[model samples]
Target: MCVVHLLDNPDSWAPASLQGLNLCGECNDQMIADLRLVAARWDDAQEALHAGAGGGGSERHAQRIEAPVPINVSVSDALLVARDNIWSVVLRLVDDHAVQLPVYQDTGSLAEWLSRSQAVKIAGSADKTFTKNAYWWIRDAAGWTVTATHGAETKVDLPDQFCKRPGCNAQLVVVENRAGAHIVQCSADAGHTVQWDTWTNMLKSLGAQKRRGPRLSKKRA
Candidate 1:
């Protein structure tokens, strides 16, 4: 039996695994390659978005100018974008009769799934279901691969140093509200504050911090 690997869900291998598709090795390889192409396209879109958001510039500029604005996309919204991107490629393949696979029962099922908060299981697949905004689908050697791209869970701890504002040496404190929004503020003053509207935004900003290397002066005579 061939195996289908979900790109997003790396941990639960068995759950996304399927069998009895009987696809030939060459056909399976081609399908997997197609799926990877789709993933690459999705990644390229993400990179483009980030670049538009000023992610490709020098570290100093990224920190000074781009740090304030958060991407502000909900997990569900992100998943929708991924689904749309993937479907664009998948639909073409289906139209061309490029590969044989199970027909999707409901054409609008993805939209329905996006609208609802509950998890919905994919048809004819065991131990696999769409939960959160991370779920995705791809054709492979086995049968189908169910995947997810929800942002990884993160733990927020106070930074040792406070205030990114120049000349401020004060310590920082992490303040969170009932809605899960957090702000890192300088204990010395509230004016020097960074607000994170969502946990994902917070994590993104933290992860996007640019590191600087020490500079050496020339010793020319």
Candidate 2:
């Protein structure tokens, strides 16, 4: 029943778990788990989309910034799309697989329905690409949830770069501001910073200069 290449162990696909289904045992379980978690996080994502990390209250660990907080409408819109897509998946399960809908249709009920009902019967919805489909769906939801819950930007250190400002020895870190725009700044001083796009251009210019080497003056003679 295998047609596509799988990267995980047992590289080759095995016989379907049930008739007309394409998921292997491990993948089948994973898909159900993903669906269940995605359902559980549905409302949290909605809150994150509208609540805005900068809002008062717990602020959900919102980062304290000196500058006007970046407005990341792109990221917010993406969260909305993720939620809608998740709902679409839930609808498909209902229509195509006869999965029962919860009476309330809220996140809590959706999670409960999946845990109690569909978790056991998702095998009926498996298709050749079911595992991949489930994985792709979970990624966006998980990222948005984590961002909303933590109000933190993922930090990546630049191995080759370090702060040269006096009294500062910290390395450079790259992070996306709330605006969904990338920034490269010193871990210790936000003042020693550059926009990601500007940094990239600077790198390119430096490389060109290095390739051209030092300029030589005409021979004195």
Instruction: Say which candidate scores most in TM-score.
Output: 2
**Predicted candidate 2 versus true structure: per-residue lDDT over 1-221, tens digit per residue:** 42112423243344545454554666556555655665565555445544444332222113333434443443343344345445655676777677667667654345456656764444444554543444344434444444443444666887757776888889887766453655566887544555464456445444545544542221111
The C-alpha TM-scores of every prediction are 0.22, 0.44
lDDT of 1: 0.34
lDDT for each of the candidates?
0.34, 0.50
Clashing pairs in 2: none
Which candidate leads the pack in lDDT? 2
TM-score between candidate 1 and the true structure: 0.22
Report per-prediction Cα RMSD to one decimal.
18.3, 14.7
Off by over 4 Å in 1: 1-157, 197-221
TM-score of 2: 0.44
